[model samples]
Target: MKKKTVKQSLAVLMVSFMAMTPFQQTAHGKSTVEINADAAILVEADTGKIVYSEHEDKALGIASMTKMMTEYLVLEAIEKGKITWDQTYKVSDKVYQLANAPGLSNVPLRADEEYTVRELYDAMVIKSGNGAAIALSEVVAGSEGEFVKMMNAKAKELGFEHYQFVNSSGLSNYDMLGMYPEGTDVNDENVVSAEDMATLAYYLIHDYPEVLETSSLTSKVFRPGTSEELVMKNTNGLLKGKSYHYKGADGLKTGTTPFAGSTFTGTAKRNGIRYITVILDAKDKYGQPSSAERFIQARELLNYGFDEFKTVTYDLDSIEKKKKHTLPVPNGKEQEVTIKVDKPLSIRLTDEEKDKVKTTLNLDEEKVNEDGSLQAPIEKGEKIGELVIDTNEKEEYIFDRKSSDYKVDVYAAESVKKASWIVRSARGIQDFFVNLF
Candidate 1:
């Protein structure tokens, strides 16, 4: 009997371990990180370098992930003095009905009651309160219709692609209890690509930064010390004390729906390097929608980013050329001139790729002589060429990798004047005689 009990316990543990990993991998070899989702992406926050991606450009249901755009606009309005944290928003009949709507995530709000912007912001973001989102939108744009316009306009301005917002909230129009913003179809839901969602998250963190203070919170009290008071727990399961509870995870957002499945936009920082990961429509082993698979994929995705990759500095001080780079200064006081690179730069790379990196010196055309030597009368700080660092990686960057990302401009440190005719003539004559001998 005891032996049977022990066997049962071992079976349970093994099942749990295999359940966390939903995809296949190579046997008896180094583990390859793969995500179980319809669309997924991992990007380095500092460099915008794409670490891993699968069908990142495919547009899918975004679910509540649409609120991220709302968060961005709220922060922008505050920065521009259009709104204040202390400002109050009075709930109306529209918000009242939705706040009381069943089978939806919301904080109960009383009609005609005023709630501060700070409170509603927390309710909407931390609790995914549908009614609070509409109230805040009304406060920002005077109506949900105008706010929907603001949401779409902001997406365009931020360079978001494969994205369309029918309402300020990520909730499907049908879920809005027939009160969805005007001019939007009642059957429509917000749609965005995995890469587009990452773009919005990047701008939110880089532009506002303060959103983390609320997003990272595992729980908050909505309308505390009152009859309507309730504790709003963050939907992001990757947060501390949440289901996944990954270390270094502070803030982000998560969403789930019948059509969208489960989607999560997660971010975490370790050793000064932060990574943002998006999992869209994650599923279980049977490829069915799941509530836990999204967070499971998020944990693995963050693990791949923080474990397999690292940030290293590629500076000019350490590189050695085969020979000292020298440029001839014809008819100048000095026969030759030498210039050096300015400084070092930081780059993101995997541990294995560190040894694969190399440096190249490219001389700008027309800036130097045919033989790669500088002519006389070279001015100080003159442009010569660039020092470029190249990394041989199989994956491409998420954005158009800029030359400025890996190349630094080189310039002459000092000026050199032309030599006198007598001196030039003497040198020319001396060279001719030497060659004759």
Candidate 2:
């Protein structure tokens, strides 16, 4: 019997388990911070990894946060060449009426006034202007009703099962549509889960990142340089030096209504890493300390995510370069071919669990020919083996060895061509002479 060394190649797959599982202990531990919201979630912008969650899948009224989707579609339309920023749209009677509605947040627009696409976008995102949002929807899709359909379709396409949008601005349906005709008890408010809202925030930033340019603005005037100048202040309290300002806080939306009670989808960037936080139904009624508890909860979640997790990059290129593994080739011009990992891997982990990370390589020896070599004519990217990684955590753990985690397929680095009979004979003679020396 012999003791195996770390550097030695093993004939069988290797499985190493640590005595103390850091991930399991961390998973079962209670959160240090309390979230006073009906539903809340925090996720990494790049990987979509959920760092902290509480009732994240509960569907609730999202108030003006619905405008995030409208903003996304408007930018998408511009990107697809369907519309332009400078294009002008005349306000309709319905849009005018909605803009001046008693309780809704809006930038007053006269039916006869014409506004550019850019002004409407700025008004909607910066001010949470419901009227501006509906007007923009009508301009893009011919009618607000048609635009709502588009929003729902896009939501479905994005893999959202717990969301429904009845309007572009997240306003209650009864308020926007004027009274249910008959025996209809369903309110026309947009309902979405915190998880889905987080997903939407991620996609909104991922696809049309330019929205942040306007969202980050503390204040701006609609119809600038014109007689009817309307100043629109951003509703997101976390931006700039606002009351609940968090470091690195930037563009995002805030929502509030009697029914929805202060929901927010906030994004921030620090040290090149971005995070999105969604808090729904955060109000003083829920034992929250203040009216601005949604923003406070969001900042707390962001702090937790940044402070607890660290991104780890598995430099597969360096790994492959260091471990020069090769496989013998039979009936070929070359005797062997080099192999390496197919792709690089990166994952987020806590400081404690980082030290437990371990990896193993297992080659499929059965693929080799009985003559102790691979059959020639090997392709450049032929998969010959696999690399398995373990962090001494259960499969259900957050950063376990899933498909999206630290796994890489080993492939042939170069192709191998078949050998000619004369070349094989010459190589044999050369090998014999070298051995004799």
Candidate 3:
């Protein structure tokens, strides 16, 4: 072949570089997202699929959003019979002083008066009442310190990698007027990653959806029809009748502090889909946005989720291929057993991801023999493996405790009892002869 001129070679190289760029970027590029915060994320509630994220890894002050953990523990205690909604608590000196402390968000409480668990919880969730949270922590754990320990444990069990708890109320230690939980610094504040906060919100709503019944209320009378009647409006401005109300807006929490700046964990459902969004350190070109500005940031994120992505569902039968496959079963009445997902699989995705998603079967290794065959006596409907959904996009998930794969467990389609002894011996002899050959 004749050598090409320098200019001709350069032209070919440029064309080749352009041709390779698209494929390289498709393989290696991260999907970039923009949100009005230091860290933010949007995830589908049911599946925990990360639709978009921006600097979601840093652990920062969460302000009153820390109450979600307290809320979870309270609900769990109620569910476990450790506490009752009507159970009453006398306001301790620390909690009473904190409740009446100037500038703190709280429902007015007098030291002499007793309150019910139900009323305190209402104040905490609906109004982001700091002292109410402290009182409830005392009710659930016998002390605020013990409740903090429970919060940390629950966070770990929920798959949180970055989080810290100094108090049940999420107020900075200094804000607690020397009443912060024992062994914590006066400057300490509850800190958590955006992803972790979203995870907390996910479990809160899923584990006890009844929370929304109160969280969704735009305003409630703290002690309606009584002398202490005071209407408490939800801090989550995105709720209906609030400053930045968005359609489908409901339960969740909002927060602000000098350290956390502004943060919000917001959830809303529409068209049979719900999205959980987290905004940490809400900001803009002008700098730290107002406390309520976090809702605006959340609205933008929820809008992107509700608009850009769509839910795609696939029942086992609807899968075009490989919906069911047979696995070998040795010494059984049947030679093989068919397996499939127990129910439909659903995931949220953008148009691009929808086209790129693929399905795969993963057999449980523990149940398979060395030769990849199952032993006889397989039970019908036994969990055998998982039906996983894969996609090319870089994805984050809230349920890291579960496998990264969005999957449903597969089960055996039918029972396979052991074959007769004579039949097994004959099959073993046939297998020996076949292998020798």
- Candidate lDDT (C-alpha), each: 0.79, 0.75, 0.80
Compute the lDDT of residue 332 as modeled in candidate 1.
77
Q: If scored against the real structure, what TM-score would every candidate get?
A: 0.83, 0.79, 0.77
lDDT of 3 by residue, 263-343 (tens): 899999999899999988777546644576578778877888788777787645544556567889988999899876677
Give one digit per residue, the lDDT tens place, for model 2 in 136-181: 9888998877888898899878766566677888887778657221
Clashing pairs in 1: 315-344
What is the clash count for each candidate, in the order shown?
1, 2, 0
lDDT of 2 at 235: 79
lDDT of 1: 0.79
Question: Clashing residue pairs in candidate 2, if any?
Answer: 173-188, 333-419
Mark the regions of model 3 whose C-alpha exceeds 4 Å error after superposition: 1-32, 315-342, 360-388, 401-437
Q: Please name the candidate that would achieve the greatest lDDT relative to the true structure.
A: 3
- The TM-score that candidate 1 achieves is 0.83
Q: Where is model 2 more than 4 Å wrong at Cα? A: 1-31, 177-186, 284-291, 316-336, 341-343, 362-404, 409-437
lDDT of 1 by residue, 1-437 (tens): 00111111212211122223455432112247777777788888877767777666666778888888888888899999999999998899999999879988889899899999999899989999888888889989999899999998998787665667888778889888788899898877788778878888888999999999899999988878989879998988888888788999987888888867788999998888899999888888787777798889888888887777667776444366445555678877887766666766777666667787888777877867787777788787787788788776444454544443377777776788889999999999999999999
* lDDT: the better of candidates 1 and 2: 1
> Which candidate number has the best TM-score?
1
Q: Tell how far residue 404 is off in model 3, in angstroms.
A: 4.6
